[model samples]
Target: MTGTREALDTAPTLDSRRRNIVFVTIVLGMLMAALDQTIVATTLPTIVADLGSAGHMAWLVTAYMLTEAVATVLAGKFGDLFGRKLVFQLSAVIFIAGSVLAGFAQDMLTLIIARGIQGVGGGGLMVTAMALIADVIPLRQRGKYQGAMGAVFGVTTVLGPTLGGLFTDHASWRWCFYVNVPIAVVMIALAAKTIPTVRPASRPVVDYLGIALVALGVAGLILGLEWGGSEYAWGSPMIIGLFAGSVVLLAAFVLVETRVPEPMLPMGLFRNRVFTVCSILSFIVGFTMLGAMTYLPTYLQYVDGVSATESGLRTLPMVLGLLVTSIISGNIVSTTGRYKPFPIAGAAVMALGLYLMSTMGRDTGIWLESLYMLIFGLGIGLSMQVLTIVVQNTVPYAQLGTATSGVTFFRTVGSAFGTAVFGTLYTGKLDPALAAALAGTGIPPEVAQSPAALRALPDEVSAPIVEAYTAAIDSVFRWVVPVALVGFVVAWFLREIPLRDSTRARATELGEGFSMPDSADRVDQLEHAIAQVLRREQRKKTGPPGPSVRVLTGGTVPETLVWAIGAVHLRTRVRGGATLTGIAEDHMVPVGVLEPVYREASQAGFVAIEGDSLRLTDSGAQQAAVFRRVWRVWLDGKLEDWTFDDPADRALLDPALDKIAGDLLDEQSSRPAFAPLTR
Candidate 1:
């Protein structure tokens, strides 16, 4: 009861202007987090120059993504238990601290550690921002705003590399990290003033052990791959120990999930064929996207003699291709509800793109390079946009949170693994090749390795070294071709199923194509899904009249008055009293205007005017209850296209419908448009 009271106390009371401001505040937070995902791509070569460990460079991106992946799962649960507003603010503070630390770092180790901290905060901001949207925005308007957020996500993905390069070339490479500080600081201030407090209805079980096991197991495996031939011998005790330890820990994680009351990832989800196949495809998508983004700039700078800024700009073909196709594919799926062909075609294109990229050499034309990149990105867009939608369409409502997070988790891990493996292959090939080419040339090994220094040498002296860098990078793409082919083969096994109406509606948002981790419970997700449909239908303006519109209120009774009665009953149930002035003020409407509506309701015998408070009479209460049922029925009808195979799903869905009905009734009833009950 106290929990419910706290939620009521902090419930949104924002006017439209203030709500928009809150939306902007959270959007900024989300932008900062997403920006970091690709911002380091162009800066990697420069950072390696200053820090002197090119071999360990992949860890910069890996550390950030790995920690961010773990943090998203933890933050989602924590936000649910504590509150989204508090979590969002704290995440901003942590991000600021991490950014400052990273900017001041003196060595590769220190920079990597700071980046890990940044990842944790960035992950928190992303998940909490999504949750906060459900808190402040009205249900009917949420979909358009969500679509706008997705658009912002797409823009950042294209712009991140260029922005990072701009900071590095004009200011200092450190500015790439320093740039987050002021933006995050402003976000925190705006969040404090504009965002409403939203308390959770119940405490959730935090899977601390499960998260740790997966994090450690994954990190250990990545460490073994990263260090195998570079830091240590392949057969060394340290490498063998790491690989062995990871297997034992991962096996233990499986056992722990089966017994936990609430696991981070439920073992049961793997039993479904679609979930298994989609997870694999998601991994390949991450592998290709991040792996190329991480190393392409290196090849451009080292072999092609391009500036870091130019290198970033040059990557735009790929990003633009990804964006255009993502939006187009999403719309197509929404219209036709058929999704299997996109992944199959996407994987084949991806394999073709990789094969073309592996053919690049010092003499390759710039146009050819861009065309290859565009092909690769197009493949990613087609395959990625529908994975989450299909998963949500197929999974039971009870497992929605875990299932969504699980797919995202796999993608994040794949990104980390991809970066690590690329680094290993590049390093392994580069070292021996560089030594062989530089032998007896009297040029220092370190000087030949540095891009700036190598370019300073005469062509006759630098030609061999350039060839080595070109061949080494080409080897990375060559190795990854098999991985993409595997994804292509797996994509063939994905079975097409009918899209739930809610899922079809949701697929129109391009953000799903980016596959960012979203952490929300089943009810919040359902509300969002329905909100999407509501928005789309609102545009067509063609749905049949609502079931409740005619039957619940006779031709004589104003629909507005029915709404007023429901609000009164809700306030009385939750807060013990409801005054006309209180309801008017909460909605930021004029008290005098709403007074007549209450007076009319009283005259109709639906409410009693007891001093300053309004109380629902027996008839009023029963009428309110019936209208709520009407809304419940209307909502249930929207999901008529979805299947509920398990009894447990219905058990979870039934209560969720009741809560949404109460919400819709209260929110609709309180609007100023409904002030004149007689109308």
Candidate 2:
């Protein structure tokens, strides 16, 4: 029992295989969260008609977003309090339960309540999934993972309506909710197997007061905007009071945050110039991406006369543009170790694209519209992934979850407000234009208001309304130009902190300091295994002669190949590390040649040489582990008939086996030519 308990308490680690599986599982949860955001919209009319609850149709979406807004922030804090894996699994169960209930809901109210439950679970999935990657993956490898996950946003953005439409048309609308069950089951199973049980070492004080205030503040602000001009007049007492109360609530939340220990959003984070700047950029990016995407499809449907699914399909250009740029920018940042350029360029491009979109009118060709979308998407693509990465780079591991969630929270709020404000502005322009078009004409108000009714009208009646709709949408885009410009200006002030390589051991980057890889021998074993697997796959390809394995047999080292093999040898063979001077003596090489050899190894990221001491970097250590595995595999075949019960004989054979392994690599493949072992 003691052994079991100790093992359970050990720090969690995973090799490449486990990491990949976990990543996929997390994406599945994210897809479900994103899908729910838009999927219900396509089936709303059918849902209302079937349930006979037309008055509450909008609540189906509003309730979900409202709860989701609160859940996103709360989940991050709770994950910090409890273990992330526990919270993540609980979220899956809750989301699954919500799906079951939503599918069985008898009334609009029941469905709305079910949706709100799902929102809570979905928010947990989103925040925890993001935080888990930061926990397990080293910082250097995070860019590609983050980039690929960001592309999930693009996929969900385009596929949500399309998938919902197919389910509603082919099967019952309930299938839209039911479909999540299987996918989520698979996700839960994967997470259970692949996710480690990780808990923070200490539980911080929970700021319940601050949490309550932030939740209320966010709810009031969203409700105020969501209801204004639709449910209540902009000047109505209810709307005015909600807005005023929201301000007071938010101000109080700020005060509570300052006073509380372990505030959900630590005020001190804002003092980090990177966090502040990135949060603002994240908000603006969300504003433009969500706001523009929302109205673009509306134009396609109302004016271009496309069906719901066709509207989804028409937005593919933007999705593709966003996906391609997201991947490219991620790879660039990973390789170049620079991030400031992408946002600077992205902001400028985004502003340009929005300006171009504002110029589009009803008569714009489909190809021209796609081009405009592509440009806008390109701009969004460049900036969005970088914001999250930069913030992750800046925050300490302890505060990582909060900083990430904060960025996400602001983005979501910005999206909600952007959509509302854009709608308010568009409708404000549209009403006047619409009234003038209908004046002195025999069109009834109700028919003109109905999209289907308006479309059925003669060209003479519909033409002016289409023109008015075109102008109104264009005005919305034109108004958004300033928001993008603000982001562009703000991007200039963003400090370009050198993104530290997490693979290189640093006391500061690890929140627990020097007590990580050294204190936990298990981490060394896990790293060793992870490196072996990754190297086995890569070593299959052909390579030029690297280090000569014959160097083991007392041959002169080649100037050309020595650095390459010597780096690997130093990492894998130099066990129980000796000082620089001792290593020179052991290798029978002069300090002069070894100095340049160490320099090559350091530059190539194989090892770190601090003063006279030497140790492998994370990358170098992994490669050494690979070498160990290769040696083990070859040595196993040669020693099959031998028995070494004695330590003295075992010790003698170990050196012989290593030398033979080196010779095989040099003679057979002119490289480290060991055959890749089967897992």
Candidate 3:
């Protein structure tokens, strides 16, 4: 990942206009997908009223959601398998088609199906947008871009309902669908031109079975939640069966992924400590974001009697806070190249904000809402992009795409689950409140309390229903506080590894690039020299392998060439005493090589000859000991294991000793035993 940054730094910079164009293209593409999610919520009433089927109102949202949830995982896999750009563009096309179809839908069923198609596209857009940003931006600069993306999300949240309401009131509600068409077309064109193409270094085989299991598991779980207690009783066999099936399928998916050669989700990525921690942090981020964002506007609209437009407008404070902080944090991360501090601080701030917001009631002031939203936004801005940067920087360049996509997948799953759980809690709270309020007010207890039943009522009947919703939504925020606090705990484990120089020298030293020098080269050269010397010494030792020669020397002189030449001569005469037999055996050579030279020395009256032993004269003994001492010092220094006791060390020492002995013999054989040795 640091390599990516180094590459980017060396690449030519784009002009302001080109950079803006690229940013705007991605932002608009992101907004189209993000805004479509919530825009339909405000327009749902008009659609139901026009189609006269309030019974299927939730399905309008549920279908889009279920398809989207499934799409996120698939898109991530395909983005990695193919290229992110291709999948992203393809998603845009699918979304545009869905938008056009929804705009002209003839019935609620058609519209819901169209929305599902749009969701398939939406999932692709969301995942690919992130992956593409990661591809181009260095880890240092990524936070700023991520922050900018967060701002786009904020803008979409503010605009979605407002635009939906405008379309519902001033024009046909279908225009809400049409609004995406032009934006989608423009984004597609810009993306084709500006988005660089990238392919994985090696293609990993897609796990079709695992993909099926994942999609089925997520779909079943989402369906069971969406329909349980509404379309069917919570205890109904169909709902129970679906939930059970979801668990089984998901378990199978995990098992299958583990054994696959190249699993869509690499299990190894989780082994990285930083990646693991960041993934947990991101999951909590998603949980908190979805859990809180899902309910805040509902509380404003249903409990506080704010119009859809007003609700959207009221969210502006949160949006503004998020936008400002996200951009600021991103820029800071880019400049500093450090990220650990942000997640820690951000999680703490977010937890504080949630804790404060959880204390709100029906009488809570707008100013308080604004304050909580600002604080919450700041916390999100600080942590969100920075965590992404942390995960990217921690992994290898080869695994960058997988690591980034894996975190994204977990976060999205968390968002979906958080939304489901929070929605369940909100509705669970609303049911009893509605039942108590409408018990004696002439409304059927079941009809007054039900989510689907509440939507079916006239505006006059829905007022109390909205009141019930506001209380329920506020109750959901109370639950979000704990989730954010848990996130804070996880953020503390994030490790901070310093980014260092990106040079090849540093990379090689750190075991990242080049292979080190060979260990056997010097050893090989020493071995060959030793073998040649040993062979020559052996030839001289017994005169072509015949019987060993006995040598006699006079008392006045040193005997053999092996004893009186080079290092051997110097060591014997100056430092240590030596016998001819000791020299042959200690040096691992034959005495025949020394015997002839000893006979010559005796003939020259250099050493005393005895029956079993030769006694060196005083001068000869002194010279012999000095020569022996020098030879021993030279041999001991050259032997590899003369200083160590290991087997490998001894093996190295053996070859070195042989070479030393051979060199000494060769030098000695060239001159007289009494010749003075050169320094």
Candidate 4:
């Protein structure tokens, strides 16, 4: 029992520290994953030559892409179920292990398998990082942090290829894989030390069927695109079968999600207008961005004959544009608390940039290329952070993780599909251009026609093939420009609602008894008093009432009691024959309280029954209203200077007014006047 108690006492402290650690670990892990995807691009030629499998070169990248795409949605759901810390830590371990395996791989096939393992871990890292941030931050403040994260993403993209090149040139290409090991180790250690462990709110049942269906759907679609025109013709049965399978599985996944008690992807989130619109816009943004970005390096290397380093350098303008714009836009959103215009403007700018880039050729100026990239980056930076903020604001805190992950998942899916379709277009156009370039050369058509055979040729044969590659890639951007324009149209529909910073605090204050200095408090008091008066009248009319009525003044009646009296009078008048009056012959009490109460009741059309001898008709009630209003104003001025500092005085007066009011309002028909009020 002592051991158990000690363990329980330390658990909360341990959990708190662990949670912070987990967050840092996840951030670093995500950085590693994102960096690896781009960093390896610069080193791919070296890797292909080293492994002696040039024909299977694209598989090295495709394997990772396929696994990462399929794992993101699954990991998101698991994080919500098992606790984000657990999934995040597990992802780090998996990523680290995959990195070690890839570093030790002897051939391209082995390296591809290792990358696939890393992709699974990479998917978890990205999804869980987003979901965890949503858990810790309030929605209103989330935009600033998300902007900071976007800056980090931009930094990674800028540095990844550069870092990879440095490693390949200075060290060995294997160090690229080994590099993640230390980062992962440090991240895991810090996470275990600082990351807090929040126990799941309720035990979550794994949606095995839903998971399987979604995975199959995404996997089939990505596989079909990745291999459709490259490994098999577009008209091949394999492509058709995979496409059909993807659609069927996606349909089943939707059906399962809609029926589940606690769904992984709840349909209810789509009910919010902002969430739905932002999600669609996020998808389009990702689609347009990935489609164009995927081929820019190819264009530079093939068309301009630039070295890999030079190609990366040419993309710096876009990175600079993203960095500057995201920081400025984030601060503006934080200060102004508005976000609608950013997306619309960003999409328009991106469309313009895409249009400009599509007009590029073999001899396009380097400055012009940089300008187009800068414009595209600026547009992306402005809109990306705002989309996450919009989605987060529209949902409850508990659903933040789910909603965020859902939007992110769609974005990733769009990126994957966008890259695949555009790659197809580039290849489709390149094959013909290559054939035309090789026309009438004594070289056989079969050798010139094949990418592998063409790559093996001398510099003379390879130059034209490279030129064809550039022009075909440029055609892909032509299509992307229009897609970005469509995104602008979608962005235009995003509705802007001002974020409420103190929504929760306001709700709490209202739940308590605090009231602001306004007529609402006074009116509320009157309503409460009227309710009490009606209840007493009701009991008197039906039950025994054994109290004598008395005329009293000079007291602060409980606000509720006053409202009850007003309510009773209003109800009595509405029922067609009742009246009330306060009889005071000599009193020094302020009349503000009773005057307003009486005036309001009369205005509501009540007759006054005063001292058992004076009764008010409609005209008499109207005549009394003028005196009531004038006396209330006068009494209020005098009462402002008066103070009931003695608790005993307040105690005695409060109960006295309550008793007098209760007894008077309870009388069904009689209105008896006691001794005249005295100061």
Top candidate by lDDT? 1
Cα lDDT tens digits, model 2, 1-679, are: 0000011122333546787988898889877987887787556545654674433544566566556666766665566668677887888888999899999999878998998899888878876776665556533244456535545745675567667657876787799899989998998998888888766554546667887887788778767775687668999999999999999999998998888766767788899899999889888987787677667766665677565566667777877777667767766675576888888888888888888888887678989988988899888888776776576566643454466567766776666667666766666677788788888887865555445566688887788877877788889899999999999999998888765433111111211110000111112222222222223323455542123234322254333333344344443342445355755554445666567766766787766878877767787556544544565564454334344455763564454345434433323321222212100
- Give the top-scoring candidate (TM-score): 1
lDDT of 1 by residue, 1-679 (tens): 0011113233745678898899999899889999998899999988888887888999999998999899898888888788889999999998999899999999999999999999999999988888788778877788888888877776786688889889988998899999899999899999988887878767778888888999999999999999999899999999999999999999999999888888888888989889999999999998888999999989998888788899999888888888888888898999999999989888888888888888988899999999999998898888899998899889888877677778888888899899999999999999899898999999987787667788899989999999999999999999999999999999999989999888999887877888876755776677788789778767877542234446666555687677678678767755678987777766566777678878889999999998779999888988887878877888888888877888887887788778877777666665655544323
Q: Which candidate would rank higher by lDDT, 2 or 4?
A: 2
Every model's TM-score: 0.96, 0.66, 0.60, 0.64
State the displacement of the C-alpha of residue 199, model 1, in Å, after optimal TM-score superposition: 1.5
- What ranking emerges by lDDT with the best candidate at the front? 1, 2, 3, 4
lDDT of 3 by residue, 1-679 (tens): 0001111111122334565676777777678877876676556545654664444555565556557766766776576567777898999999999999999998878987998899899877875675565554432233355546655665664467667766776787798889889888999899888766665443445567877888789878867876676568899999999999999999998888789875656677778989999878877876676556655655665555565556666766765666566666655554565667878888888888877777666568999888987898778767676665465456653455456556655666666666666756665676678677786678865454333456567777677766676667667777777777777788888888653212110111110100100011122222222322333344457422111112212333343333443323433433254466754543445677666666665565545556425555565555544444454454444332223335664564454445344434334432332232211
What is the TM-score of candidate 4? 0.64
Better of 1 and 2 by TM-score: 1
lDDT of 4 by residue, 22-109 (tens): 5556568668877766666556546654675433444555556657765775665566467667888898889988899999999978
Total backbone clashes of candidate 4, pairs 3 or more residues apart or in separate chains: 26
RMSD, one per candidate, in order: 2.7, 14.2, 24.1, 20.4
